[model samples]
Target chain A: MKWWLIAWREIRWEVFLDRASLLRTAIFVVIPIFFVFGNRGLPGGQAGEATIVALALQSVFFPSLAGVSLIAATFTAEKENGTLVPLLAAPIRDFDIVLGKLIGMVAPVLAACAVTLAAAYALASYRYGAERIAHTLTPQLIYALLVLSLLYLVTTGSVTMIVAARVRSSRAAQQLAGLVIAISAAVFGGLGVVASQLADGWALVAVGVLLVFFDVGALEIARRVWQRGEVIGRI
Target chain B: MIEVRNVTRRFDGVVALADASFEVRPGEIVALLGPNGAGKTTASRIIGGILAPSEGDVLVDGISVRVDPNGVRARCGFVTDQPSLYDRMPLLEYLAFFARLYDVSSPDHRAVELAKLLGLDDVLAKRLGAFSRGMRQKVAIARALVHDPPVLLLDEPATALDPEMAQTLRSFIVSLRARHRAILLTTHDLDEAQRIADRVVVLYKGRVIRIGATSEIRAGGKPSYLLAFAGEASAARDALSRIGIEAQPAASEDGLAALRFATDDPRRTNGAALRALLDAGIEVVTLAAEERSLEDAYLAILAEARQ
Candidate 1:
């Protein structure tokens, strides 16, 4: 319950109220529309397929990067601003603070992904047709865009939070988060290419299951590492 | 009540705090005085449960910090030197956030009440970034009181405040003491500590070198008196010598010759010294006992510890 309170506060202040975050989310939401328009000249079947892949990659890549940066700032920014001491001094449990920040940082990214997917769908359906777009939006692609994307967000967010807590400054955390994003984009982009070439949705679903395991492991590591003393000492 | 029992903290191989122990009773303020890098903040953080001790423990209202740090934290309110606040958040929301974390029944109500107590009710809707330094500090104090914890840890609460604002904060802290809270204040401002603290704990190199009442620490040396005389220095010296007391020539601004002497028993020796001067026909313009300040005692204590 206290974790929920912390998450809600973070979402309200850091995501919704922060102008820079809003701008990043807005750019992500608008990026997929351009991709949909770019594929407008293809045949109906090919255009529908291209739109799905493009949307999936856009949904996973952009928002996950955003989530990584946001999560990276979670501890380092608080430390830099001198807020971490009072936060650590609070009555809330250490795990709750870490879990709350993880959830809080991931929530906005997921919301932006949802928006980007919806916009891509509407634009692709208008450019081609609803039937073709519906035929291309299979269950496995949905899983890839939503479930797999969520797991990826969790994994990256947890790792970034750990990095944020360990680094001496926010700028250093952001640079490290950029490195995380680069590695993630390479792995995810390779998966997208493999799934596209093999024309196999279940293979991506199998990968999705693997990600669930990775997500749990990352979260466990985050919980065990982030303690009040460790957080305060970095500050 | 807060009892810090032989708490030691180390960073890597170096010791930040070594076997520091002190107690702050309910309704009492114990000032933790130290110089830079003296581990005052480390001790405060350990007591507040933000940092754990390397050894030993701190008990807040009988709750051991090592056993239940969150419970001890629940009973304590820590005010750091900087008013580190969420500048984008409104004052009331900021207070309510902490109140909720502390599990208050009515967070909004408690936030408003604390704002009122700190005379910040009118600016509850304002964002913290828009406030001045003093107002921000008041907001920080209000945030600490949101849960009404019985133990308050204030680390240089009046730091960087103007004279008027510092006086106001000092008055407010005294008022908090009136409510029977155990207050541990770590400050370099010896004057402030002398004015409000009931007991003073001197920490040197992460060790508690001295702990006693404020008056006892200030009166670390024998009581001394300065006698300003209208007569010559030779006459004042001769009078004091006749009384079997040695006096040193002291500076005086009013064109009066001054002689200073220390006495173990001021009540008895002062009267005898005055009688000797009067018998010698020396005109004593002023006979005042020199007051030893906390700063003086602090320096002397540190010097002794260093030696």
Candidate 2:
């Protein structure tokens, strides 16, 4: 007898008008294209193309921000409209409220990430199919994709719900979400600065481990915030 | 059945509710009457399991709301005065979604049934964003009733409805009572409370100062008879007093002359007041027995309680 109708209701409006934050969805998919194939031969030997494909696979992190924004925006909008309390007043647990909202955002955001990555993979194969992607994709690479996406989601899903729950102003939420995106960009760029030295399979494994660590860390911090009465403390 | 025993809820230094105690029996309609910010909403929320009381126990059908909150919530259908319905979803889908939350299966028939009961059939497919205030209120009501919980906590159930629509809701609440659903209604409209509530609890500040069966507490002491004559106002008061009826001059100036007599027995006062005037040959132009309004009784109770 538990459900997420409130959360579904929160996200449905975003999907229906194609109005609520489609621009973020667009940016999430489009930015990876530029990094994957646009600038070639930056770090390695004549293996310029394979590195780009690897980077494209690694850039599964982009949609993480999209998920955060969707959850944050949903909460901010509901609080502004005074709909949050009535929705919360329904027969659901306090924690379940956050879970439903996170599910609403994370599902759609992850779906968009999957679709955009498919398009990116097809383009990469068309250009350098005979080389880095000579055969169909490898299990190791698929594992990396699956693990990275999972980590990114667990981290962002938790953090975004907390951010959404704590804030009052929609502008504040947007600005706060914008701050998170900025931080993510810095982290992404910081990885590039150290990429030339450790440019190999070892580096890919290292980055994968780091992403998982950060994902777990962010989720724990978010879970703590949600439990401390910050989510439903106010109106 | 619900029981709130000396529940006091405080935030920091602000007291939202203090030592508030009241009860609702099975199949009872208890309208919580108070002015804005009089802790009406806070008390209702505590009962609905949306908020916890600072220092008291709220028991619902023998289950404490704080200890087994899910149990308390499961038995309640909660509705706010305003519609915070999720936007973008069709009204019916939203209801169906809540129906699922209550683990309510076969909701297609249930939604259709509630839609007809609440007159929400016409707008079932439309998104809630498109509904008017009245329509939205109906949808909010539908959301609460979808699960058919044993208890209904309603805050201004018809706040947004028109007069006729409010009448419909009032009657619908009566029907729910017939179904043995205990209802807690909070509204500013006293007449509505007078019309539908089996009992009324008036809250002042944060405590329940007065409560009983609606008609009992508001039944004031007893009825009083009023007499009016065109001429000789003092002469009429003297004439009525001779017959052992206390005829105090209510309006003794100019063309209007009136006297008031307090009596526990309405029939005796009605007969004696009329006979004294008629036998004395006093010109009794208007004579009527005034039944104390629930309003007058309410004000007196409030004024006395505040003191």
Candidate 3:
């Protein structure tokens, strides 16, 4: 019931007004501009697939990574500064607080990711004709990418929440979450290299399946471990 | 009403509270007085439904804390010892935020009312980060009262405030009790406890040593007074002794001598002692009853409990 309160607080105090949060969002914006403009000189058709793959990878990493930072900071900072205890002490349930935090953090990053993807799509359409772009952006591929992006965002957000749940210091939580993401990125990047040896569809299916498993696992872990008393008490 | 029954809290293996119990009824202020680590905050947290007790239960307005904590929390307002608010928000925004959490009908109106009541009207627009400690405390108190809940748990509510502000807070709490709202306030300041609390609950080492009316708790010991003089201390002692009064020479600084006297009735004993001192030519520079009347009783209880 107090999800709205938590979301409003995150927006008012952590998002719209926080300089660090704004700067991180700004950084995401700049990444999309770089991708669109930097790849303008690439040839159309088959060459465009490489650019598309690059854009997909960017979507998987930037927004998800940014989401991790936002979620971890939002939770851990509130815990550290004593604000979380008051909110927890309120009539709102623990799950609602977690849900509100996820929405508050993931919503903005999702919006930014949408803009980045759209800008990349528009630039691709301008260079390559609408027909070529549409053929390349098959419904199946788009669906896969969308599923993958959602999984990445949620997986990162949940993992961050899990880490921040036990961590008492906001800065430490942020650093630890970043470290986990960085390690995951390294493993995924290695997998990306291995996927280059396999067929495109098979690779996408394999990686997407793996990400789905990870997301489910993280969500389950968070569900079983997160308790209002343990979280607030540790803080 | 709030009932904390046999509440005990343990962190790791160390027990913070052991079988602590108390209740706050409508139209009464229960002061949770204790020394450091006496489980005052722990008991307050449990009653507020923030921290769950390890051994027992807390019921707020008939809602069990363990069964429906949110229900218990909804009916109670808590002001923690630390005013940990979002620094990014204005004072008004902070209060309004809590009002919304309580689902108050008109959050803005409720905030303004609380702010005015806590003397925070002037700084409503100022960022909480820029406010002084006393200002932050006012906002915290205002936040606790934002929804006008039936129960309030304030941990050291008057801490870090000037005497005037503290007095204002004391009066406000008294007024709240008059409205039939149950209030449980924790304070190390015995004088503040004596002034505002209808009943005093003394906790020592996670146990409630004493709980009763303020008069009943403070009624244990005879009143004591301290007299500061600028003449021969030995003579003053002799004068008090010759008149069959017992006086102990306390501390002497410069040419002033200080003596302590305790009596069952200070009004009668003080006059006799003063007359005896004056007649003996001991200049009575200052004569006043000692503050912390409740403190004496508290320590005596602690000492007795320890033994």
Candidate 4:
């Protein structure tokens, strides 16, 4: 279908080997590893662990922001540069654009996620110097980080793209996406504070389940909204 | 064939178009002519499946845009005045993007043919941002035509072109007719519309005022003749009216006479005037036939509508 074609084109399927996305993803993950451990010994308190986790979250955050730029840049830049009309007039559906955009957001987001995990692992091993990495490098921890990163991608990227689709300026969309990031960090930070006190796994699972529901719901909403039409009329 | 019936569209609190109706059959080029703020773009957008009309139905090849926008877009090609494209992309890449979007199995053929038609083959690989506006326009046109849709809608497609490029675009439109694509073009350039359109549609305030063949709509040598007499055009007109004619006083220049009459048959009006001059005892020194222009008739219609 034409819709799938748009998604494929948007995924930069042909440009998967491009260095820009790879560099953006790698730099996002590796930079924090540098700042977190400057050839220093490990800290031994609950506060240090929390800070380390928070730093890990930041690594997840910044590179994910790059994905935001890519998503917003796709639509807004197209509008500014005059490619929106031709694409809109193509024999494709609006849902195709939405799906294509969503597909496009995934790779960069996943790359950012990959970089975040590597940075987290590197920072853990360097600061703790072979002690904490051995203890915390469990299957549970890896799965938890993967689940958390996917949740972040869905929660942040969907809201960011919806805002992008509603605005004409690509810069404005990216800037607006910064707000979504702030809001997401606040919500997650609050949830983290609350979940730290929960009695068991059920509570965290409930929230994770809710996040998945919202993520799917957001994609569905995005698909329908874009199908309605573009952000602005043709000039 | 595309049929747009009673299409109306509103934006926020303002009505952009209302009670607009028109149709384009196969192989016809209909120009949607209007001044600024006349909702010409809205009409074109609706036909192109860009916007859903607030009311009425648009059927393209019997497919409704509102009901099946994807289907409608698949069958139509729309070239807006300013096409938004990626600055980093090559022209051919952009064309290929659209061709693939339209589900062209062999996009290379569509891309090559469209580039050739729009004369964009030379710039197919050039970065779009580096190209001039005219070059970009050509690429946009190529993108639209890549799908081989039966219907084409161009909104002031030649707005940024120089005279020669504009002429080439006009001929390109004429070539689309040979492809049997039904086209509806929106433009304020009367000369361009006059030259390229098979039928001209004059729209004002979101409604059609006139729709007919271009020659009929722009019959520059109008059939109205005005003559004025020094004393009274009635006596002169009375004599002139005798030969199946009707004449009225238009004006008096110096001491000579003048009267106005409507006669599509110039031969009949001329013969009647010659006989009337002799019968009225008016000096036969000078007799020149005058004709009203298409511009005059069109302007008068607008003036009357305003009143």
DockQ of each: 0.73, 0.40, 0.63, 0.50
Docking quality level of the chain pair in candidate 1: medium
Question: Which runs in model 3 stand beyond 4 Å of their true positions?
Answer: A40-47, A186-220, A223-226, B91-93, B119-126, B222-247, B250-292
- Encode model 2's per-residue lDDT on B80-103: one tens digit a residue: 887787667787787887777777
Give the alpha carbon lDDT tens digit for every residue of B90-209 in model 3.
Answer: 888888888888889999988888888777788889999999988888788788777778999988888778998888878888898989999998999888888788999989998999
Per-residue lDDT tens digits of candidate 4, residues A132-229? 66564555766676677768777777777677767778679878877887888789767866875796656777788889898778877776555433
Summarize candidate 1's per-residue lDDT along A134-219 as a digit string, tens digits.
Answer: 78876666765777668778878877776676787878988999998888878876975686566456576677778778777776
lDDT of 3 by residue, A125-213 (tens): 78656566667777776666656666667777888788878778878988988887887677766875787579964885787788778
lDDT (Cα, 0-100) at A160 in candidate 3: 79
- True-contact fraction per candidate equals 0.83, 0.48, 0.79, 0.73
* lDDT at position A48, candidate 3: 64
- Model 3 per-residue lDDT at A142: 65
Candidate 2's residue-wise lDDT over A1-235, tens digit each?
1435645654566644556478767787788866656744335444654575465565576766776677667777776776765555565776666666666677777777777666667667776653555344555665556566655565556666567667777788877877776765576557644753585547756876777677556555565664422333555
Q: What TM-score would chain A of each candidate receive against the reference chain A?
A: 0.87, 0.72, 0.80, 0.80
Q: Please, what are the lDDT tens digits per residue for candidate 4 over residues B1-307?
A: 9998898887775788888888998888998887688889888888888888989989999999889977998898888888666666677777777777777888777787888876777777787779888887887777777777899999999997999989988998998898889999898777787777888777778878777787776564446765544545667767776776777666667787777777777786677687777778765445555643335545665666578
Candidate 2 docking class: acceptable
Ranking by lDDT: 1, 3, 2, 4
Q: Between which residue pairs do clashes occur in model 2?
A: none
lDDT tens string, model 1, B1-307? 8999999999776788999988999999999999998999999999999889999999999999999999998998999889999988999899999998998999999999988888899998999999998998888788788889999999999998999999999998999899999999999999999999999998988999999999998887788899998888888788889888899999986788899998898888889988999898888888899998999889989999999
- Worst-scoring 10-residue span by lDDT in model 3 chain B: B288-297
**How accurate locally is residue B105 in candidate 3, as Cα lDDT from 0 to 100?**
95
lDDT for position B141 in model 2: 84
